[model samples]
Target: MFAQALRDILQPLPPKCDIPQDEQLQEAMNTLEVIVSLLLKEQFDTWRYEALDGILLTVAQRRDADTAFFGGDCILITDQTVSPIEVEVTLGGGGAGLVRVCCRVGEKQDGKLMRHSYDKEHRYRTLIWQERDPHHELEWMYFVERMYDENGR
Candidate 1:
């Protein structure tokens, strides 16, 4: 169910004619809130989660009049963990046509900055997640474990 929900949320937006880009970006931000709620329910003793709202900016470089940038972070918290994995989302930047989602572990894990992009045409594609993975498993958990292992936890 989690995997399916992630897939649905990450699905590409409709064409600009069918749905305005601003509306599409807003819908994506709303869906991210839902996903964060789901993540909160999956907490265990070793780790918990929190969502920090990102800033909405309307700058001259943006192309759409109604489009304001939206973004946020999902932080994974753990004991003895000074640096947590931050899963971030960005809508409307220089590349206003694509919604960018990235997971940054920390300076220690600089080599593993996972980046995913959602556009209007193609179905969602991610670099690390596989369809055959367990439905209840989230991609972020993999990074959390890696962070722990690398830190000798």
Candidate 2:
């Protein structure tokens, strides 16, 4: 039920729309971060944000997989996954432009469990936050849906 509701809310934009200006892009990322933080807090009282680079490289060696982290460049590493359905909340930048919040999917090479810079072009879904709506009605849904989908629970 939640998945269906979330999917309905995160419908992607039309293919030819213009990219948002820098200010708008910043606003979208901020809004996305806040929404994700709130929802995750509601779902898990222990929710927290760690740095993806640091966590992947060091801290995660002795940490739990359910830990949440801010993956720099507006990406949130929701440490929840199952093989091919790894999920991350990437907002703006990273060649993805500013209008949409991306829910990217990729498999770790050689079944390896390490973080290294790599291209993400395999598969992704996104939700365009409508700049016209200051209330941010639609932007919140993508986090919920993608979190659920990528976590695959």
Candidate 3:
């Protein structure tokens, strides 16, 4: 099972990996959710909140040369409450398809930084400046919400 999962993840790219930019952002958000969910389950189960916080810092610091992670922005969480966390991510697009993209990052638990996606789907996340004129193109925007199973102590 592990081997198969690895194979699926390490699978080669398609002949032309052309996709919408919004799709790319959505995929990234989903990926983060699954990863954070699994990691939190493991950490929270073993060491509780302490383990969760410790592992979060550790995980956020991992990245490759192309997909680097950085402390772009952060929020402070103090109160012990059960609620969804919301975040906004703005990335200036480069290369071919899109010139900029934005996405919401935090959820109910926490947020982490990782390698940025270079997929063409980033085009969907681009923001438009229709207010100015037809020749106006602003950065993209996205709204993400992190929902917990319950809202309680």
Candidate 4:
């Protein structure tokens, strides 16, 4: 059911010149709704409403607004409401066929980053994490464990 919905939402559309700009905007809006709905199911406390403008601005970056694709970063507050998980979304040119959503979890100070991206060609999601100090990777692991533990409490 979820897969079908995603497929429908991301289905290719007619060329930008073929469709009206308003219709293109509507299509982008619909895609945004689905993305937000999926994100809400996660453990984030809340999404920052002000960040939405950034997404629109990204879409408007191109000279031709109708053909402009979306690319922007938004923050999802952690369950404890002390930190933020950044989600960066980018769509392929002309607004359909390919999409990339990257989520960064953990702290910059600790030198840990988690990236999650969906590959349209492969039809799969990939999760990759990096740590600066390989020798002390366990510290980063414990940090995440403690964060979840605290959130659970």
Candidate 5:
């Protein structure tokens, strides 16, 4: 159980987009750290984000995936058996009453995910304070800049 706490962030940089890491990234990262901290602080009281297993951050720089694919990728967290807590955050803006954030954790495969672990529920929406936080909307954008194209290698 403890082993699942450690996650490997798999991110690749793109060739077409060539630019040094600037203050923008730092600002985003800072915002993300703060937002994540705030979420964890509040969410921990009822749910445990720390025990969410492994986290995967991915960014694609192409539109082959979809029409609205503005080079965005999904952030995934895998469980012990490699079940996915995939959160797809895109550029969203709307009215004050509506909070624009989509968070999804894929269900367990068929019978079980791994061993005795079986996912009872799947797919959800995470309440985010702002879009500038880590693992939020901008986090995906941060990763997209560092993504590698097909010719990157």
Candidate 6:
């Protein structure tokens, strides 16, 4: 499922003239929904949330390269009384995709959110394009778990 969804996003669309930009955006958004859904179920399910705001996916053409990359963030609505937790995902462009997933699981303290001594980050590289990649799944799980721990949740 992960590989298929990633492939849908990574696959090149019909050239700009052939496909409308809005259509491409919709397609990417759909694929991103699938990706984030998978991550939520497989990685961050342990974190209880009353609701999840829609994932925000951003895709941009790389100025320095031919390939484009994607980045996204989702707010997990944990408790109505507190601020939502934010989880972000960044995907790099290439035949071998690289993903960075992290989460901020805390309320603002001293005008800073999760301003801690340790920087919890996870980086993973896919084995190949359009292939099942567990590297990213593991990285995402580790990132969320670490963030949850750091936040004393």
Best model number under lDDT? 6
Score candidate 2 by TM-score against the native: 0.28
Worst 10 residues of 6 by lDDT: 118-127
Per-residue C-alpha lDDT of model 5 across residues 1-153, encoded as one tens digit per residue: 101110001013333332233453334333433333334444334224423333322321211111011111113233343223322222212211112212333333453322223233212212222122545432111111122122321
* Clash pairs, model 2 backbone: 50-69
User: Sorted by TM-score, highest first, which candidate order results?
Assistant: 6, 2, 5, 4, 1, 3
Tens-digit lDDT track of model 4 for 1-153: 222333333344443422223554455655653554344434343333312211221122222322223322222223212222333333344424324444433334555333222233112211122212325332211111111121112
RMSD in order of candidates: 16.1, 16.4, 16.2, 14.8, 15.9, 14.0
- Per-residue lDDT value at 35 in model 5: 35
TM per prediction: 0.25, 0.28, 0.23, 0.26, 0.26, 0.32
Highest-scoring model, TM-score:
6
lDDT tens per residue, model 2, 1-153: 322222222233332232323443334334444554555455544345521211111000101111111222223355432111112332222222222223322223554332323224111211111122335322221233333323332
How far residue 151's Cα lies from its native spot in candidate 6, in Å, is 38
Q: After superposition, how far is residue 116 of candidate 1 from its true place, in Å?
A: 24
Evaluate model 2: give its lDDT. Answer: 0.29
Between candidates 2 and 3, the TM-score winner: 2
Predicted structure 5, TM vs. truth: 0.26
Candidate 6 lDDT over 1-153, as tens digits, reads: 332333344455532222223555555545544444444556555543433333333223322222334333333444322222334433344433324444433344554432122112211111121243425432122234222222222
Clashing pairs in 1: none
Q: Give the C-alpha miss distance for residue 153 in model 2, angstroms.
A: 24
Any idea what lDDT model 5 has?
Answer: 0.26
Q: Taking the tens digit of each residue's C-alpha lDDT, what string does model 3 give over 1-153? A: 221222232233232232122443334544444433444444344213321110111012112211212111122222221121222222212311111111233322224222222233222222211123435322222232223221200
Error of 6 at 116 (Å): 19
Q: Indicate the TM-score of model 3.
A: 0.23
